[model samples]
Target chain A: MSAVLTKDIVKTFADVNAVDGISLAVPDGEFMVLLGPSGCGKTTFLRIICGLERQTTGDILIGGTVVNDIPPRARGVAMMFQSYGLYPHYKIRDNIAFPLRTQRVARAEIENKVEWASNLLGIGHLLDRRPRQLSGGERQRVALARALVREPTVLLLDEPLSNLDAKLRASARNEIKQFQQRVGTTTIYVTHDQVEAMGMGDRIAVIDHGRVRQVGTPTAIYDDPADRFVATFVGTPPMNLVAWNGGHLGFRPENFLPRELIDDSAVTEFSFRVDRSEYLGSERIVYGVLEGLESVQEITAKLPPAHVDQESIRPGEWHAFAVRNSALCYFDKDGKRAIRH
Target chain B: MPRPLAAAIREVSFYSAVLFFVVIAAFPFYWMVITAFKTNSDLYTLTNIPFWFNEAPTLAHIKYLFTQTLFARWLLNSLIIGVCVVAITLVTALPAGYSLARMTGRSGETLGIGIFMTYLVPPTLLFLPLSRVISMLGLQDSMWSLVLVYPTFTIPFCTWLLMGFFKAVPREIEEAAVVDGCSILGAFIKMVLPVSVPAILTVVIFTFTLTLQEFVYALTFISSSAQKTITLGVATDLVRGDIYFWGELMAGALIAAIPVAIAYNLFLDRFIAGITGGAVK
Candidate 1:
């Protein structure tokens, strides 16, 4: 059975649907990431799943049991907040032990579980110190340990790495992913950063404006986005859309390389004008408009640095660029993906 | 002027301003201390230097305050009222403030403002109706009347103060606790209240000191000398028409002020920022 499942959850705040009907199932031991931009209801959806927030309509099930009327503590879920939310006054030991103590677990077993959790997170030495005394990364580990101490049925994390520095975020991401895998706990992670979602998620649920736009494996979500929003929202220098046959033709920047780089027999060609070029060490991004669609739309082509020397593409000049026939993504006027006509 | 000399002049003027304010603020305490210790003869003599004692200092006034009057009973009454009122204020205000702080939209702000507005109605105006209520409760001339009436002011202001504080306490902490096997009230008591020690201390000291020094309501509600609070007793019982017992009055004021001073010093270090640090960004 799926460890956690929501059936058409809708949470309305002040007549505004903060979490509009979102139904998702997180299978046992799967890392499901809810990915979106800020204020996109991803966190709200996670909160609903955790029982921190009640859906205005619909039922929540944990381990196949309906938990609509159950409180957060009884729902067998644990959450790590965006801020890490370690109890500021408690020592790390007590913070990790708090959940078990609340459940009135046996004293010796609480100690053993606390030790197991601290050991799992490798925070055994910092047990006596308080939360404020720890660094940001340490605090994140402590929060993770506290969430994992009880061995919950589902683990919900809401942007838990956002408070760390850029350098720390990468390693913290690795730590949490590896830690989650080691424990094999069903996890639902929320984040706006595509890098984290793509790198760590077993499956990514792309959400926007209180609705899930797409739910697929990261590779599928990136390579075969279900809609224009997912296609445009997931990649850096996002997918370029130009007016095509009264609809939109979408192609990733990396796929729209110079014609010289295309080895495929089937290709669609465009006369690309390079207005600006940025050489970002590993790749070159060329920004320009296509010949016929110049005034209406701008397109981008990301070329691998090895394939194109920086001196080759000059600004304010025209060059031939093509996307393989297989790489083109057609979308209807409503931003839904459509098969090529 | 040369740069060094200009800097020197600025430095001198800054210290001079600081010294000026310090002396102005401390002058009353200095006067109280000296008068409390001065002998009756030195105080009554016109030629004696007012700032310092001409005769040997004595504890005679403090002795008189304790033995010759209901000063000890007044102290006990003030302590009881302060404790009771602080308890009531915390019990009422903490939950009220936490809920108000967490309440969504403009309603929390509106309700908080409504509660604080009651605090702005001065006790001078409030005492008339309050006195009627005190009499109706049959608590007139009892220190319990002051205890009952004090939270009417304290809870409102403290609730407003604590609402601002609890609002600053990140909602995520309490939410985390709730998810980690706690009820909403448990989260508040475990997660919210621990980090809010500084704010709670501020409320305790504010309520206690306000109760200790309050006179108007104490006077209106409790007419008996034995039931008078420290402030009311010090002022009224130490005065006989135009003849004021200045020594006993100063002694009483000095003694009543000590606990608040100690409380401030005791909790001032806790009014720090790092309590919630490392928990959030």
Candidate 2:
């Protein structure tokens, strides 16, 4: 069953259409991520689902019930914020128990749940400490614990890991996924980081300009993007987009191979001048300007260290390269993916 | 070495300037305390004696002020009015300020600004017409008149003060509460209020002090000996027929300033936190 659903949700702020009539469904126990650039209404859509924000005109159903006019508290949902939003004055135990206490659960039950949550998050020893005393990662765990302790039907996380440093973000992301899986709760995660969406989500909804560009499993979205935006947005160093004749050809840098590896009679082959190369430990990223293109089209190719001699390939030297047929993505004039004929 | 000496001289000059300003600000209060304990003869002599307590200090003025005049009654009246005004101001201001802070859209912002602007309208201009309104309610020459009138200034000022404070609280914290099954009111009470204790305490102190020291309204509205507040009673009785009781008047002034001074000294951190927190953000 669809645990949470929105149909044609529209939200406008003054002259700006912040959420412009978007629709989607989050199935039971699914980790759905709304991935987009900042201000693309991903967070707005999450807020609408959590009932923190009111949609201008839409139907929001949680667990198959229309909840448009329902207040957030009655919606049976909990949100973990990007800032953690742990009550600075409350100890970790009270913070986790807040929702249960508000619901008038028995005191023993509240204590048991708080303990369970703290243990789950590896914060059992820190329950007596206030949020101010905890480090950023600890506070984040406490926030997650607070939300999970409620055991709501759905959990909404709004860029919850964005505040952490780079190294912490990576480990924290895995921990968040692990926690969500163990809880088996329907989760809607919002982030602009495509890597996070790819790593954390069961299904990724790529959004831009207040609209959903595509929604599919992370693998499908990455391998067969619905549009040029999703294609470039999902990859490391982004997909290399080069205008070819009347259409645009997209391919990942890792897919490009040296000419010696490809058959001479290959169907797609291009000659380019090597402009620059960056050595990223295990692989060399060679940036080249395509020879026969009208625009200054630069294509980057990731070459394994074994295949090419770094000393031989100097800048301003022309080279021939070929892309694997399965790796090439073609986009028509409107920037939409053209179905392969 | 020579450069260090010049720097030392500059530092000494800076400290001297600060000391001069501190003495200027504090000298009047110091003199008030000393004069309060002085005999009538010592006050009349007006000597520039710095440290020595030459003559035996008398508590006659303090005794006379307390017993011979309606000073105690006026003090009680002021205390009653101040406390009531503070309580009323806080009750009205907190919720209203929270609403202004959390509610989105242009209307909420406009309304918040509108309420604050009402505070800026000069009280001196409004009090004359407000006096007529007070008399119509038959609160003239009564402590109740001062109680009712003081809130007109206190509520708006405090609401504005607290609106800034409430705005400083992160919206995410409130949202987290809401999602945790808290109604808007619950979120306010459980989350916003606790974090905002310092700001609220500062507001209480400010309102209490303002209402306690208010002169124009208290002087204008109340006329009876029993009904007059501290400021009115002291000014009227001590300066009878242009023969000022400087010694006794200073004594009364010193006594009256004690409560607020004590309150401030106790909660200095909260006051600084509220003003700086509210102002900067």
Candidate 3:
């Protein structure tokens, strides 16, 4: 059975459709991410599945049972908020034990569960401390412990790492994924950061303007974006898109290289002026205007530093770059990817 | 050398002004205590001998107030009314405020504003109409009238204050509680209320003090001498027709003011915090 299935979920606020009739099924033990920008209704969708919000017209099934009308407590799901909502008045131990206490578990069982969750999160020593007394990372761990202590059927995390600093966000993302894997819980994470969605999710659902644009494994979405929005939103320095007569050509900066690396018969070669080059340690990014094209159109190519260094390339100079035909992506005028021979 | 001299002069002038203001405000209270102990002749003379106590200080007025008058009974009546008003204000205002904070959309916002507007309407206008209502209810000339009327003013203001307090709680904290198996009401009681103690204390102190010192409604609604509160009882009975019992009156005012002053001082930090916490985002 599917761990969770949301069928034709529709939520409307006044005249605006916040979630416009979407559907998806999350397999058990898979980490699925709803990736979108703010105001895209990804968080609203997560809330609806968690039962914190009600869908205007839809059905939700969790663990093979319909839970459309179930209250949040009876939904058998736990949510971790982005703000790390630790109860300020309670010590960490009590905060983690809140879910068990609410279920009226025996006192000894509550203590044991709280202790086990705390120790797993490496917060055993901080159990006696209040949330205000702990650091940002520590408070996040407490929130995670609280959510995990219940051992719910599904775990919902809403932008849980957005509040952390950049350095901490990377480490926290890895730790959260590792923890989810160890617990083997079916997880649904919502985030606006596509990098986070790509790095953490087993499959990503790209949403925009309250509709799902594409849903696929990270590699599929990266290499074969269904539309222009997914192409531009998924990658860093995103895919370079240029208008063609009847279609569009899409390629990544790294795919473009010095002409010598390409087999002459199997490559498409283009000449461009080297406007500038940025040394990014492992590779150099070359930015230039395509030769014989409109001045407004600029192309970026990522090449190994040795090639650019050997050629003595500098700004305001011209160079020839090429790519294998297999590496190029074609999108029709409607922004949907078109098959290329 | 010139700058140093100018700075020193500025510092001295500032200190002098502060001292002058403190003395000016405190002199009347000081004179009241001095006169309360003086013989009736000393009071009539109105001498400017401010620093010295009466030549033959006596407690005759204090003795008279306790023994011959219903001063003690009136004091008891005021305490009972104040405590009851405080309790009622808290019970009604806390939940109303939480609802406004949590449930406010456009309509709730309009209703909250409307409730606050009622609070801002001057009490002078309200008391006249309220007296008729009080009499119709057969509460006039009784402590019950004051108890009922006090909450009308106090409840609106306290609810407004607590709405701000409740809004300051992060929504995520409450949502976390809900996910932890708490019902909405359970989350409020278990999570929201405990963090809001400082704001609640401010509301309690403010409602109690305002009810204790209110004069117009109490004086207008309650006509019977037997049922008078401390404010009306002290102001009316202590002073006779064309003869102000200056010493006895001052003594009575000072005695009545002590409890509220002490309460304010004890919860001063919370009062400041609650009032200002709403001003921040």
Candidate 4:
């Protein structure tokens, strides 16, 4: 019942449109991630839904009620800020109990709910300490505990993992995903990191320039991007777009492989001259320029360490590379996806 | 000089500079204490080494101050005025400061500077005009006039200070509170105020001390002996036109000054932090 729906949400600051006409729906218990580069209006859109920022013209509905006029607290939503924003003077128990206390929840019930939320987040032992005393990861969990204590209909998180170091980020990501699944509250997470979106989101909405380019599962966003922007933005070393046929031919780095390795009968061939290669512990990314194209377009091939031996690919040498016909994506002159014949 | 000797000379000069300033600062208190306890004859004698008691120290002047003068009354008057002014400053400045800090764009900064400009106006120049207002209110000889006047300066300065302190507090904290179900004012009270203890403490101390030390308006507004504040009473009551009661005056000053001195020392670091406002952590 706690689904969130927004209709044509737009927020303008002065002459600039920070969020331009974003309409989205989050079904109950779904983990939706708004993914974009920095300054891409993803965060602004999330804030609009949370009621922290009012959209210039839009209707926001939470649980079938149009909540455009409702304030954040009345809308039954909780947001975790980028900085965690834990009250420095309050003990961890009091921090978790704050939202409940504001609503005049009875003292005994407040204590019970605080204990439940803290224990759920595995932070029961740290409840007596203040926020300044905790580590970054511990503080993040405390923020999560405080947000969850209210049992709000929708949970909004704004780049909560961006503050954590890389080693802790993966584990924290797992904990959050598992916690959401267990709790089953509709969640909207905003992040600029595509890897996080791919690993964690039930669905990812790729946005740019205050507009949503596409919204789909991570696989759909990755393998079947709707346009050139989504194709280039979602992957690392991004989807390689080479000039072809008055438009561009796009394929993922992993899909563009040595002709010897791609065993598929229907595949497109290229004379890829190796410019350089990077040996990443698990895979080697080979950077090269393709021959027979009028313009020298740079592209990369991701080779698994087991499949490609070291010293086999060297600079100044040419190799035959192929992409499976199905994996090849065609874009018209306007950069929109065109049907492949 | 040899390397070790050169280092020794540098250390000696540094300690000497520190000791020189300490003595310069401590000498006034030393003179005040000795004069307060010294016998009048011993204090006045030209032949006796004035640094120490030439005669036995006695409580005669201290007794005279208590019995012959309204020293205790003046202390009580100061306390009442200090408390009242501090309360008014807090009630007015805390909200004024919070609003100015939260206000967006160039206008808040401009308005804050406008408010602070009032604090820079000299009290000596202000007291003349203020006395006219005092007489119009029929508060000519009442200490309540001081309670009303001290905040004219205290509120402006304290508001400017508190504004800076509140601005340094992360906006996310208040925003988080609003999302957690508190109204904006509720967020300020529960979240903003608790974390702002050092700045609030700074404001309290600054307002209290300023009220304690103020003399101009206190002297202008109150003419009767019974209504006089400590600063005005101590400076005027212990002096006869041609002769000065150095012992009684120093005793009054010593008693009045000790608390303020101790307070400054106690909260000096936090006071500096509050004034800077950006270095809350």
Candidate 5:
């Protein structure tokens, strides 16, 4: 097992800094995800690690050897690109065999490895087909077969599942995670999809605007985000954040419920109107402005769809909601996580 | 009139117009081919009907073309020059275009547009100084002079064409190849170049034709009969002063057109795609 490490990588294009100083370490066999929105510099960080783009200042190490001056081909890492990057003119077998051929591996060994990889990817039957002939999912597997055949110490995937349909993306995510675990290779995956990151990463690094906001296990980051950005960025319906107590108070919508539903153990309570409601089969989200500060703030509370008549939660009514103090996350002046238990 | 009659009349008139234009377009080529095979005696006769094959077709004009003049030598000179131009243009343009497309960013685009502007600089204006440069190289009568000079125009256009083509290939593919153990140059040869066949063929055909038929420089710098290209030699050597040897001239012209026509037919799909796709993409 080979660990991958980056020490303070930074990249700038023209006057705009793309990847701010970022230092990360992926333990041997760990699957780490650099999660961020587009233009947030996650891809730039991955490119820097691969030596495809020179960092303005940094040190990169794979398998304990410094690789700052190494070219991408010699860096001992393979990346599956967002585009799948199969050679359009070559068949799947040749695409998978390319890296080995470049390394001057003997023809017989190259064929063996190509076969092994295609089998591992469940794409052995598609070897004779060109990339343009394969469906998106098959093309994706071919790309993975190409990447894995090299068996580099570290594997980098840049939004590899982004092009798949939603259902296929979920399955591909599972495939990638299981594959990484089985191979036990240090893998760094980059994606803007929070769900994919949380589902596949052994640890997720939340990044925004070229900086890493927080890095931790998915559960830890979800339960205890390191900053306001992470709290809002990691969860679906994103943690509902609002101006409060001279800082920012945040609570997941699920934690905000009808006043009667919250017990005496609730730490904070508010009177807000439910002007809009969305029933999501399993639950209902009631949205409205906070009472008295109606013009200044709004809040949404999620409840079981059975709790109230659908019409009662409709627009033009006021309702009260409360939050369990434990579920609240507070960020200070600069949006850094500062809540204390 | 019944609707069927009206429709028939409209269809007939439309096809007639199409046939009229088609004949107008094809007549010269038809005339040239027949003239190439006609004897000088048959060609000069005033009483013979011109449209159909009335005389026994002879290869006399073509035979004279090969034997009486340096037409063979000129054709050979053109072939050599065309090959050199294609080689130099591809070697220089593919890498220059890739670098401009991948490395230079906004500056590369500006520089590329600037280089294309140099190609837009008419060769008629540059021939005088280029002639001086050729003479300075001690290549006053050398066909190598044309080989060296043709790229001055060929490279800029080829580079522009290739830059459009290379840029059209998504950068991720190249990056993936790099990650899969290829150096920048290795990726270019193994991946980028192979997928770029249409554009490469376009560059080859474009430069080859341009170099073969280019006359001003060939006429000005190359005075040696042996060094003149087919286009220059046939027009100058085949005619004595003012009289045109229609049979021989048409034969030479037809021969010159054959290779280009065959080349276009061979890569017709790629040629059209390269023209429309690379430029727009």
Candidate 6:
């Protein structure tokens, strides 16, 4: 296994810069996830790293070799396409063995590895079946088996779990994570699903509009977002942002506690007008517009479901909530993080 | 009329209409087969005699076709030319179609349309100048003349046909193959071509039929009896200044139609799939 590194990569399609100058360094055996919304160039970045797409200007070094000019096969990168591009014509065994066959591995060794991978993914009995005969989860396992069977320097997955159903997506996500750890193969997975990124990556790179907006551990991205976009995009119920004293203040929904929880007057407080509230089993999520703000902006506040007194709060009513100063993240007018003295 | 009887009557009329069309379509094929089996007196009764046949069903016409004439040689020439045309069309069109389907630039559709337009130009218009070029190369009066001339039509049409089929294949499958250590050409061979079996079969049948049935170029370029294809031989050699060899000619026509009919029936489903492109998905 080797660390994959990109130096100032830029990909321009005619006049549109699909991937702006972005540099990334994925350590050996690390699970690096590129996360973004659709058309955000996360897939493009992953494709460049796999050599399926060429960068207009950059160097991709896989295992310390500049692989910018090398083809994908020579680069020793095996990618599992988002659709689990299992060859429809090939049996499961052959699909998993394709990369090894291309590498000209001996027949005995190829069979041994194919068997090992199929069994590892709990799909050994499916070896004789065509991809069309298998379910989506089975196809995903076959795709993963094919990618890892060759034992490449890097494994690339493009939204691999997105095809599975919701129930399967969670389990498959964990399986992929555990599989990557077991093999200790350096993997770069691309997904538009933040929960996948949050749950799967050793570190996540949040991408937007052909640029890396933030790269950090999942907890850091959740707790200390670099800017307003990351603050709002990375959290569930999303982070609430409002203009306060000429600065944009960002706070997580969970960080907005009932007024009794905060004893300090120095903390930021909001008279949140409750527009609606949802009772999730663990948390009571209250969504509303903050009172006394000239410009209209909505906010969400999370409370313990045990403490959700149904008689005390209702829709179109104002509620007292306070945000601890430490919990407040400030961003400048341009949405860049602001450090207050 | 009562409702049930009226419904039955409608069904009967519908079947009769279908039967009428079927008879109109099938009568000529029946006439060819019956003529091939008829004795000399049976054919002389008249060309228009309805349900015509004689008491005797003779194999004499078939015997004359195989023994008395160079019909076998003409059949072999046609077979050789048809196979060569298919091979050449495949060699040129598969790659050209792949390139057209996978082309990244804006001109891909334009170039594809331009190539298809060449197929629309009448072969009758081309044979005039093509025969001169054929004789210039000293390939005149040989089956090679037709072999060389046929792909000029086949390649363009096959390329256009296969382009649509190749485009129907998902780009991700090829990209996946590329990442699995296949070169672009390797991806096309191992993945694209195998997935395109139906379209390839369609192209084979089309090129086979075209070269076999093409009469103008074959007759115009090759005047020697030894070099004549089946179509040219049946139409020209069997008619000696309007003295038609009715039985032998029909026998030759019947034999030629058999292989094409069998091939179509064998690949009818696949041919439909190739045109519709819904087999795999």
Q: Each model's TM-score?
A: 0.95, 0.96, 0.95, 0.96, 0.95, 0.96
Clashing pairs in 6: none
How well is each residue in B138-251 modelled by candidate 4, as lDDT tens digits? 888999999889999999999999988898999899999999998889999988898888889899889988998888898788888899888899888888796899999988
**Higher-lDDT candidate among 2 and 6?**
6
lDDT of 6: 0.89
lDDT tens digits, residue span A1-341, model 5: 34888888889898788988898888888999999989999998999998888999878888899999999999889988998888998888999999998899999999999999988889999989899999999999998888889798888899999899999988988998899888887899999998988899999998898988888999999999998888888877778777766678788888887778876674688777777888889988777777644222357777788876686566887766788898888888688888562
Fnat per predicted structure, each in turn? 0.87, 0.89, 0.84, 0.84, 0.84, 0.84
Q: For all the models shown, what interface RMSD does each have?
A: 0.8, 0.8, 0.6, 0.7, 1.0, 0.8
Across residues B1-281, which tens digit of lDDT does each residue of candidate 5 receive?
99999999999999999999999998999999999998777788889888776789999999999988889898999999999899999999999999999998999999999999999898889999998899889999888999989999999999998998898887777888888788788889988998889999999999999998899888888888998999999888878888999989999999999989999999999988777755675
Off by over 4 Å in 3: A292-298, B56-58
| Candidate 3, A1-341: lDDT as tens digits | 78999899999999899999889999999999999989999999999999888999999999999999899999999999999888999998899999999999999999999989999999999988999999888888988999999899999999999888999999999999999999999999999998899999999999998889999999999988998889888877677766665667777778887787666568877786788888898888888877765421367788778656835667887777777778788888788888862
Score residue A189 of candidate 1 by CA lDDT.
96
The candidates' DockQ values read 0.80, 0.85, 0.87, 0.79, 0.81, 0.83
Error of 2 at A203 (Å): 1.1
> Worst ten-residue run, lDDT, model 2 chain B?
B45-54
Location of the lowest summed lDDT over 10 successive residues in candidate 6 chain B = B46-55
Question: TM-score (chain A) of candidate 4?
Answer: 0.97
Tens digits of lDDT, candidate 4, A13-112? 9988999999899999999999999999999998888888899998899999999988888989999999999999899999999999989999999999
lDDT tens per residue, model 1, B1-281: 89999999999999999999999999999999999999999999999889998999999999999999999999998999899999999999999998898965579989999999999999999889888898899998899988888999999988988888888888888887888888888998988888888888888888998998888887787778998889999899999899999999999999998888888788776533323322234
Q: Go through the candidates in order and give the clash count of each.
A: 0, 0, 0, 0, 0, 0
| Stronger candidate by DockQ (4 vs 6) | 6
Looking only at chain B, model 1 earns a TM-score of 0.95
Which 10 consecutive residues of model 1 chain A have the lowest summed lDDT? A292-301
Q: Write the per-residue lDDT of candidate 6 for residues A236-317, one digit (tens) a residue.
A: 8788888866768888888897788777887877788888888888888888888776322568888887776666778888
